[model samples]
Target: MLDTTGANPFALSYNKLMDVALLLRKYLPHMVSFGMFARVTDITPKTVEELKNLHHLKLDSINIGIETAHDPTLERMSKGYYAFDILEQLSKLDEAGIRYNVFYLNGLGGKGNGVASAIATADVFNQLHPCIINIVSLTIFPESQLYQEVINGTYVEEPEIERLMEMRTLIDRLNIRVNLLGHHVSNTVPITGALPDDKAAILREFDKAITKFPEKELKAYRSRIWHL
Candidate 1:
């Protein structure tokens, strides 16, 4: 898979998957492992078994978008799966010995729901246990449904610092042993480390971020640099 596909390759038919695997075996003889972007809702027991077979052919580190674990937020964000569905699918992935990284978008639940979003997300992470968790705040795209929602006053975005606070709450609530990565275009302060081991240190880093960047300035900075 040498393509940037928005589609879940696993959602394709068995024959299609076999064609892909055969193509890779023919062309990339030395590459033992590869990765792809997949949605959390697309996994089933059959998909997990196919993924396990793909793992035998050296497919690794699939990136899944959990985005938010709050059911309302997931629905508003247009994610096809709810928290329980995500947990169930990830559990299947674990049973299949397939490794994956999960991406969580901050500010998905907006201002009043930040803490709730964080707590729910942390709850899912505690159960699912992915290899890595990538955190980044939401950014608006003019053509997307989110931008329309924001413009029409349906989605109220939280302040950038409020999003950071939610991120802090997530860090604090994390009870697992996975790596966390927050160095992205949307992260105000880049935080990289593992949980339960560097928990205190990560909290200190978040405190420093809080002190270094005030809410007002962060709001302006993020808006100024906003892109599609």
Candidate 2:
């Protein structure tokens, strides 16, 4: 479920999604495949169980912008949820046999914490077995609070090369079988492959970025990106 407004769909009512699901199943019975973007904090055991009852509707896929499993980074960005919440909420989905794709915001922990962020995020993701881990490098726009933080010296954006290293670290530590989608517009290098199979090739690409590409070139590419 994609929300263009970036608001949590179930923020208002836990039953809202179920209500919609019922309508879809009744009116459009042919529509079986379904996916939606949802916040883990907004999902409950009841929501999963209720959806499971609708065996005819294939609402088995979900995309969650988990961002980072690092608590300090989550709080710094004001994500309104914590690491444990990710574990608890997602476990409900796992139990209900729902497949999910998650977003991993590279450089979310800022300059010094990039590696740590990757390790922490990978730890959480490994347990859940996400279908895809979408890797996006954090980009701070002028109007964003993060931009203000950067201006005020409260936060430091990760160096482009470091961001690549962070992504490599995440890939290296991931023990689960999942797709790593790094083709987002925010990424400097578009890398897409499955883990444990393309692991070596993926690491090679990251190594090339870290060694072959000049930092200035990567920075220039980043500067050209105005939005996510």
Candidate 3:
């Protein structure tokens, strides 16, 4: 069967899911394997079970943006769900036999908290199973609320070097076997490979970048990009 998906499939209500099933049957019968993104708060045990039972829909995979498992950083970013909520919801997905990929946003904990955030995130991830861990660095734009927080002195952005260090720490600490993707435009270094096997090489790359790349050079690269 061909894989078919949408930007945020779980955002659909029960009736909308039924509508989609009917449309798929009528227009794209071969498109049975489904995958999409969802927020941690949007995932519920009931919804996961329902998806599992809906054999025709075949929603088998999902992507969740679990930026940082550190409670303070999660709260600071105004993520509606906490670390416990993430574990609770993802456990439901596991029970329902659904696979998921998660995002680990670098520099989420601000200036001095990068390493702490990395450690906290690694702790949470060790207990779970995700096919992929996608990494992206935080890039605050002028129109974003985070930018306002930066202006008011309530939030501080992590430096590029610190972000690289945080990324290295995360790679070093992760114990699970999964693909680590850092190809997002916001990242200073594009890294992608399977974990444990490629862990040492990934760490070495980060170490090289940290030692050789000047702060102004990295900051300049960040400034040139307008979107992530």
Pick by lDDT: which candidate is best?
A: 3
Candidate 2 TM-score over all chains jointly: 0.91
User: Candidate 2: which pairs clash?
Assistant: 1-35, 1-36, 1-37
lDDT of 3 by residue, 1-228 (tens): 646465777777766776777676678777756677888876753565575664436767788999999899999888887888888888877777878899998998999999999988898888888999999999999999889999999999999999998999888999999999899999999999998899989888998999999999999999999986
lDDT tens digits, residues 1-228, model 1? 333346577666646666777788788887667667777755753566776787777666578888989998888767778999989988877877878899999998887888899999999889876999999788777878878988999888887777878899999999889999998877777789988898899899888888788888887767776572
What's the count of clashing pairs in each model shown?
0, 3, 0
Off by over 4 Å in 2: 1-7, 45-48, 54-56
**In angstroms, how far off is 19's CA in candidate 1?**
2.4
lDDT of 2 by residue, 162-204 (tens): 8988899999999989998999999987899998999999999
TM-score of each: 0.90, 0.91, 0.92
* Clashes by residue pair, model 3: none
Please report the candidate that would top TM-score against the real structure: 3
Best first by lDDT, ranked: 3, 2, 1
Off by over 4 Å in 1: 1-7, 45-47
Model 3: CA > 4 A from native? 1-7, 45-48
Sort by TM-score, best first. Answer: 3, 2, 1
